[model samples]
Target: MSEIWFRTGEATVFASEGQATDAMPEVVIGSVKGPVGTAFASMLGQTVGHTRMFILRDCNQQVRPAAIMTSKATITNSAYVGLLGGVVQAALADAIVDAVANGVIPKDIVNDIAMIVTVWLDPRTAKDENLDQKELYKNNYEAMTTALTRAMNQEPTIDELIANRKTIRHYSLEGLDIE
Candidate 1:
């Protein structure tokens, strides 16, 4: 086997001693750069929901036919958790794609997503019984808020928080929040 040398902005040349042989063609991998919108649209268009079924099935398998036998409510709750996880994953993926398309930096995507989930899980803005079903909403609210504050390096102002709350409520009641 002969070694190949690469030079930047220069054509690859074979050394006298290192002649190219009839081997498999070299596979060169290159970075792709393009319009963020196109890339995001392509990613979001792919089949991303197939894991939901697997997750639900795993949950069912774990909770069913135990020696002691699981209650119907226990099984139901397990299914709900799996379903909810899938939903949240899908929602976050969509949000991230949109954010990237809109020029959000890759480094800041996590914080942006944290802020988004915080708003979605805020009890003050939660609509219907989603937030009323136990303290899940409250717990998520506290955790996400803390994460957002830490990421921001400072606590968000009251007006800013209220605006986010209102925006989320409007988004739930009306279609997308217009702001």
Candidate 2:
């Protein structure tokens, strides 16, 4: 493969359907020309909870940037695994297809580029039977679209970051005393 450009982006979609279904995906978009690609190729090995797998548009096709997705959250229940591998995976894969079609990812480099997205999925999602499956799909779909779009566009420019630094804090730190 010939050397090509690289871009990275991260975005979170949360507090939508429910806390259990929030999606935070950090995407690395680049060719096998660098470290990110190396990481992508190597992520197939599974640990206990994080089962790395290629996101497929169907049984035969993997979404381009040739995306790979895995959850960081430790999953203890079989039900959680079902949701993570089922609806959530389908949602994220669809978003990736849209990204390529929408020009958020260059169509030409679909073969050359690869993506490895670190996804954060709260494992409690399976405990509640009444949780809306459609909402969960929508939440993750939005997250992947936002992340890929921002990656290709290089969003939140340095100026934006500096301007928001004082007002915007990590959500977990919302009630903290730090300044």
lDDT of each: 0.26, 0.81
lDDT by residue for model 2 over 1-179, one digit each (tens)? 63555777887777554357788888888887677788888887888877888897668877776888888788788888878778888888999989878887778878888888887777677888667788788888998889888888888789999999999998889779999
Model 1 over residues 121-163: C-alpha lDDT tens digits?
A: 2112123233323233233323322332233333345677787
TM-scores of the candidates in the order shown = 0.23, 0.90
RMSD of 1: 25.2
RMSD of each: 25.2, 1.9
| Lowest lDDT block of 10, candidate 1 | 63-72
For all candidates, what are the clash counts?
Answer: 0, 0
Model 1, residue 146: distance off in Å is 16
* Clash-forming residue pairs, model 2: none
Name the best candidate (by lDDT): 2
